[model samples]
Target chain A: MRILALPPEAPPMLRRLTSGLRRAALGAGALGVAAFAPQIARAATVHVTVAYYSAATGPYFKQMAAAFEKTHPGTTIKIDVVNWNNLQQVLQTDVSGGVPPDISIIGTRWLLSFVKDGIAEPLDSFMTPAFRNRFIPVFLKPGEIGGKVYGLPIAASARALFYNKTLLTKAGFPNGPKTWNDVIAAAKKIKAMGAYGFGLQGKEIETDVYWYYALWSYGGHLMGANGKVAFDSAAGVKALTLYKTMVDQGLTEPGVTNYTREDLQNLFKQGRLGMVITAPFLIGQIAKEAPKLAYGIVPVPTGTVQSTYAVTDSIVMFKASKVKKQAWQFLDFLFTKDNRVLFNKNEGFLPTTRAVAADPYFQDNKQLQVFVNLLPKAHFAPVIRGWENVAKAVIDAVQSVYLGKAQPAAALKTAATSADRALAQ
Target chain B: MTASARRAFAPRMLIAPSFVLALFIIAYPFFDIARMSVYHVSRFGILGGFAGLANFRRIFADPVFIATVWRTLVWTGAVVSGTILVSLPVSLVLNENFHGQGLARTLVMLPWSVSLTMSAIVWLWSFDANHGMINATLQSIGVLRQPVQWMARASTAFPIEILVGILVSVPFVVTIFLGGLSSIPSDIYEAARIDGAGRVQQFWRLTLPLLRPFISLAVVLNVIYVFNSFPIIWVMTQGGPAEGTQILVTYLYELAFRLGRPGEAAAVSLAMLAILMVFTTIYVRMQMRSAEP
Candidate 1:
């Protein structure tokens, strides 16, 4: 028989573990002091975290950081470039850890949450009339919430149809279909020719947006006047039903749920798809990858009203920053007319500033002009908490309908319920 | 100290350091999650006022969570059993001395060297509805008139995911089997053969009983790994074409990151830990009972 208890020798072993732990703690404390040493010596360090849009995004920010540092002595701009996929999670972690950057470029949709959390510094006090007027009014509207400006639009784009010119022309709509009915007619004709007709996106991020184009056209709003979800209403069902009908008729690409926006873009580039709706960046992609593909641009095909979705990414100063002044200076430097033009040109984003909009490079591009013209009739994603939840619910519902598992009305009702539950949380 | 007391406590003294390390590594997270599970945590990991059991109630109420729990079980069972079935034959063949044995072993372990994300990505491209190698090959071979959108629905996507899960798990399981095979003394088998035990009889009566411990280890470890597996399903389909292919872990990730509900996600994780604990306990109990005379 033996007792299961520590003997006299165990105390020394315990002392060893504690001593080792003390050494590790001392080492960590020394490293912490080393990390803070630079903070004490430097006059000010403005850390800016920007999302990577393209290969050019990092270098462009680094150049801006250098330029800003050169103009203002005793200040340093440290630009941290993060991938778009990880941007939100990184920001969430940073914000929670109480070490977020002085500034960040975030999706405008996320600005609502940032503002609610009191993490975003209100920009109203920093803006002069001249400085505010530098931006296009429509582009700036998305960054404003509850009568307070919290962010500045860093990049902007609106959606429109990119049609295969050869197919649409043979199908008797050379300039592309102008309405939902015309789209059906053109798609039917294209389907008769043994290729995909409409290129519908159903799998990933923008699956809900594809359906929303039709929803907005048919006079559906994401929320009711009372601020409850309204996309489950009649117009929304009609919009989804129309897409389902097209899928059933084989007028859109087969297995619509298998295709993402990128997949549809690929089909369009391969000249096997008649039409697809996407943002302005596809213009640059086409010029690079499929220069001879012969495509044309048009507004998203109308249902009862002409409508398209506009989206923007915003640069916001953090309320937690110790160096807000220096961060604002960097933002101002980056948003100058010439700098904006360079950024838009390099990243294929639409001009967010009035000065850059007048640039000849944008004005002369016929394909891009179509997207710019659609701005008057564009709808931005509504500023609401839990937008991702709404988006997931919508994506799931749309995919189910696209996969022919549920009827449009039934799926939309279920989604509205799920979305409401998420919003409540 | 007395010699008898020293013998018992010496082992405890040695284990104390590692026990403390395990507490830091595992127990801290378990405690943190347990706290979050009962609280109203914000999207960015901030704790609000206590909301006792709200997160767990929310998860239980969610239809997707219910479905994901069932699917996770299926994913673990199918992948683990399928892996054992495939690996047994492969490891048996590999156990025999043969020409190019090292090359065959290296080829079997080749996928293990590649990152799970990379392998999942390669599989994703291969199973793409169009312009994918599998679709192209199938079309060329006249086996399929049109390409199947393998990821468009759960029916095709989940099976393919299970198959990939099996493929990746095979190497690990086979290695375990080979180790077990090596441990069985040759003299025992020789004695059995001399006693007129045939190949089938010898294998059934000798090889299987000897391999019981390794098989149990493979089953337990693989269940935990595959149940929490994210990349293969996530990179391939992101639990989509709808949430049809969702398992609990993937759903937890979507909740924590995508939907910004870390509180609920913490609750889900605790539920997962509880399930694994219960399963392992029952499994070990059965194994121990069977081992008893």
Candidate 2:
């Protein structure tokens, strides 16, 4: 037995088994190294989280991410889509939990509070002069707070007077209203046609925004030069009076107090409403959902001034993000000519970049061009810290006037008082 | 270890994870909220230093908060009483020897299975001003000349909200009443009938007395649930039309999430907790008294 062991195998079967075992071990070692080799060679991917609202624009974001990742290898973009109504609460929760996204698209009005709270990182360092000059100057105003740029306007919107052409022609007004008086007169005629004339949104979310269209058109500002509540002025009363008169004259649906923006848009799409002051996005929705309904888009009918509410969604970098450089790179990639145009086209928002705005793709679109023309006359909502409370107060005041619970002046005064208190806080 | 000690240790070890989970989930949050009630927490959740009872004082001083508290009580009372009134008769029908008793029970339980948010959404569509089923039916039947916007005005919105609360709460309330009815011995009803008692008399003396515990449980639970209910009012109206439908819970939500004043929200929460605790204590006392032989 000792002699057989020293010779390594007494039988051919034993020798064959030993050779097979050695081969298997070598193969296993080679496979292990091969599996780990790529992991060792490639650097760890930098993940950047970007939060945005709008389910409609989610696909464009995904496309943007794919394009960005193709150009920048070893970097990934995580898109967090939140509902617009819950965006603030979700972002606040994320911030309190110490896990805010690397980048986010926030409401333009929220830029001030975010900066004050140190939630937004100043983009002055990341923004080059060329890049700074790329955005429309007026569109960038809200993003700048206290002499620092905390956000970059990614998407911009200006409210337009969208009219159901079929309803307008049936009401004997082939052309849509051109002035506030004409709108009121046309609304009465439309109401006589057994359909609601003007679809008014009076409830939460964009209630204040709807109010702003009339307020800005009537030459009212939310705050005066001294930073006191200014919506209680004469212009504010006129704005509120316009809405009350619409309701009183039976020009709007009886349930204007509860009508949401979508509710009004739906009525417009169904041809039950003659006119509505809404964003360009409603055009896309109407075209898709109610293709038979002929519609017209125009600059919102003027009061004292021919201005519309202009709101922008801006891309903001968070201070807590470890991938700030990568996030900035992705933002730059997103603002490219083709990407910006496609994104704005898909969203029905005006292009924020000057180059994209001047491009033939956006310039040639008549409906979009209407909004682009109105951009110079657009007025942004106040971007103060407590503007949400002010917005709430404005909504309440307008609802009170619409519901016949208070006079426009009294309601505006009460709203101003409440807003002043909120601002103080 | 001794056998008794080993047995106790084994059970404790088995329960340790769950006990820790409960402490983290319930006890920790409760204590943290209590602490926050007295401190000034900013919109960003930074502690703005000790504020003592300033938040509570501010809440108490606010007329809106006072009105919200009153409105919450009214909502809770209306919802709980309405639920009991509806569920009692439904449970009586359910307890009968019907052919499709099992099917009836399951069908009635469907509303409870549907999420509150989903129910609110469904109700919103049904109560829609222009194209809702309710409005269309009312108009077709000549009950309404013009469609009423159910969620627009405070007067209509409040009643509609209560009706919604009753609809959602009836399933669970009916189940509890059914359980109570089943547990009562048949012989007791027989004995009452033999003693010359009628159906109404039997219900009052025997059925109702036996169902006291279940009724108390239902009332207490419904009180808590309705008082703390948020999504229904939130989804339906968002406490709008000049904050007419603003209850304590919705007000607290606005304060915490919308207004970004967590400290005041905590105070509001603690105030709600105090009210609930009082009701719970009374419920516990009644339950203990009922348990006596």
Regions of model 1 farther than 4 Å from truth: A1-39, B1-17
Q: What would the per-residue lDDT of candidate 1 be over residues B91-138, giving only the tens digit for each residue?
A: 988998999999999999888988999999999899988878999999
Instruction: Give the alpha carbon lDDT tens digit for every residue of B220-255 in model 2.
Output: 888989999998999898888888899999999998
TM-score of each candidate's B chain against the true B chain: 0.94, 0.90
Which residue segments of model 2 deviate by more than 4 Å? A1-56, A169-173, B1-21, B282-293
Candidate 2: residue B183 Cα off by (Å): 1.7
Task: Compose the digit string of candidate 2's lDDT tens values, residues A61-115.
Answer: 7777788888888876656566777777877876776656678888888888788
TM-score of chain B of 1: 0.94
User: For every model in order, what is the iRMS?
Assistant: 1.1, 1.2
Q: In order, what lDDT does every prediction score?
A: 0.89, 0.83
Instruction: Give Cα distance to truth, residue A344, candidate 1, Å.
Output: 1.5
DockQ score of the complex predicted as candidate 2: 0.63
